[model samples]
Target: MSLGGRGDLTARIYRQIRDAVLDGRLRAGERLPSTREPAGRLGVSRDPAGHAGLREAIARHAGVARSVRAGADDVIVTQGAQQALDLVGRVMVGPGDLVAVEEPGYPPARLLFRSLGARVTGVPVDDEGIDVAAIPDAARLVYVTPSHQFPLGVPMSPARRTALLAWAERRDAVVVEDDYDSEFRFGARSLEPLQSLDRAGRVVYVGSFSKTLLPALRLGFLVAPASLRAALHAAKRLTDWHGDLLTQAALARFMEEGLLARHVRRATRE
Candidate 1:
């Protein structure tokens, strides 16, 4: 049945309960937890990491636009890029692990790593992006806003990108590439993401809809290597179980219809 209003929503829920009872899945005295599960039931089922269609859409979009090497299985939908960082940290970070971030960088990222018991340190950024040489040798993870550097608006130079990837490989560390706000570039050629250049699976590319679409949407995704998949999924399940499936479905349809590209073009022009 079509859900046109509150009445329709109620009727849909009622029908689901009725069907559950009929199937003997729910006993007569059993009570529903009365949470967002109702909404999940109202639409498609949820995946702890993300909806499958949305994951595929993200992979296709990033592969084409950003040259990110990812498949649908590598994409994990997140509450936002912040949660993507959180998941990465949960899986990779440990107490006393050194986490490097750009100086004068994103505060939330620094704070998040610190909260996870990581020894978060800020490495200075020059016109070339983060100074990779200054990053401590013991640092196991480096977070960078390379495409359009946070607050600085400087793109990481090609040499710097190569150097960062090399450093990560040498240290056996991970790099979290926050490619936020690259969609709105006006007069510059886009830089290839670190994830695209990372042959050793050292980079995790994160993107968000908060800047592209709407902040209230709370939509974001991360593209990670195959090795991190199982741990990332487990972290996602432990953190929130899953995101809003209906919104994910809507975004997937939007991307599949090519509306997102058109919208970005129009928005960039304006």
Candidate 2:
């Protein structure tokens, strides 16, 4: 490849490694040597050696746009919302941490927390959502699907929502709001997230675009208190440097243009 053509070659290599990581060929926590070292080791030129600028290029390619405003500092992009949850589990819950979850919540959330050494406590759910009174004081993190409980199509009631938030605050516990299908509440104005009520910094809200967009998009964000955002971001960086650059770019574009909201609207209407 010529000097100018090296740009295209670099993109290819970026995608190759990125795909490997995403595809399970390269598992999380696997170390990757310097790009140049890999190129040299593979008998290739340095054309594919520089990845410093690859992140931005990939972010743009993935339709992500950058912005600053309400809840900006707290959001960290991840491979997907699943990884975001995993990151939350890793950084927020230590061994034996009590995790309160909806009785019939997303199976993955419970499993992930358990995998991280958390003691999962199942709280009964109703149309109103997870019962706050049932929550154990030992729980450090309360994982709930407030907008809509998974598979049950249950949206937690207003009173229950308020009570849940208050419960989290009174205990100084962290609430991980899985706003997974929030965009699909359908026909009425969307309900405010539980995180919105968190003035005491006890809520760690999460959002994912996997449902509205393609599953392969693997895009999501976590809105937490400023104090914990840095730790979560550090965990994110350690997990995947900065997530898929191109995917982040594509999602940013989707967010910046309001296309994402439109798509969600259309889906909800249909």
Candidate 3:
């Protein structure tokens, strides 16, 4: 929905509720709790450390420690994976810089790179994910959905993953690995993330809870190389000082208590 439409709906709902309460149609005292009382009961702070809990939760969920050897400091919370991509684009991409992406790929990503004044080249994908050979040497960033490729649902082969990393290393370029929908692998064993295979810190791993949990939550994170963390964090701060604290705190408790793992298992079964 557009922002204007959402605002109109919210205003309409509020007016309806207010009118009902003011009339005798709705019993506000019995139906609704006092806002002032609830406000006093809850303690809220705008600490960036709130993102730390979320970062840790993402690290545990994605197996960053064991699989990618990344620590909590490597993670930066974003509004969603889309924003994470935007931040990476802002940090690494410049006008006329080349960005290689799959031909039949995620449209928003392609649009995003273009919005940043990047020259996006579409590389074809077969059963083995994106054709690394098609990527130009001048490309500064390569965006890919390695696990369960978007629309096609083909996992990038281990050999392709290694070759992509090697190409990035040789060209001093960056690879943005969007591990979307990897958690729901139904049959085959999931391959290790490119981030895990990368030894030269060439991969920026991005993941989102929108697919696994709920899209309304709008929570996602990026695991970047130590060298890029400061710039990425600055980008995040400029974009939005931080994400929702209450949601992050609640999610932290959920993951720490093992509820998230249980939910994922149950979801997979169903």
Score each candidate by Cα lDDT: 0.87, 0.68, 0.81
Relative to the unseen true structure, what is the C-alpha lDDT of residue 235 in candidate 1, on a scale of 0 to 100? 93
User: What local lDDT score does residue 204 receive in model 3, on the 0 to 100 scale?
Assistant: 97
Put the candidates in TM-score order, highest first. 1, 3, 2
Q: Write the per-residue lDDT of candidate 2 for residues 1-270, one digit (tens) a residue.
A: 221244444555666688888888888888875677656655544421112233233233222222212333345666667887898898889998899888887898899999999999899987777889999988899888887787676778899988987887788788888877665555564567776666778777676667878787776666567778668767766667655655554455455456766776688788
The per-residue C-alpha lDDT of model 2 at residue 106 equals 86
Please state the error at residue 140 of candidate 3 in Å.
Answer: 0.3
lDDT of 3 at 181: 75
Which regions of candidate 2 deviate over 4 angstroms?
1-69
lDDT of 3 by residue, 1-270 (tens): 221233332234445557768897778456764444433444322333235556666777778322755666788877789999999999999999999999899999999999999999999999999999989999999999998898798989988999999999999999999987767877876888899989898999988889879999998888899888888877877778777866876786688777878888889899
Question: Candidate 1's residue-wise lDDT over 1-270, tens digit each?
Answer: 122233344446667777889999899789865647876767633468787778888999998888889998899999999999999999999999999999989999999999999999999999999998899999999999999999798899999999999999999999999998868786677888888888998998999999889999999999988889889999999999988978987888789889999998888889
Which portions of model 1 miss their true places by more than 4 Å? Answer: 1-46
Please give the lDDT score at residue 36 for candidate 3: 41
Clashing pairs in 3: none
In order of lDDT, best first, we have: 1, 3, 2
Please report how far candidate 2 places residue 59 from its true position, in Å: 16
Residue-pair clashes per prediction, in order, are: 0, 22, 0
Task: Report the poorest 10 consecutive residues by lDDT, candidate 2.
Answer: 61-70
Better of 2 and 3 by lDDT: 3
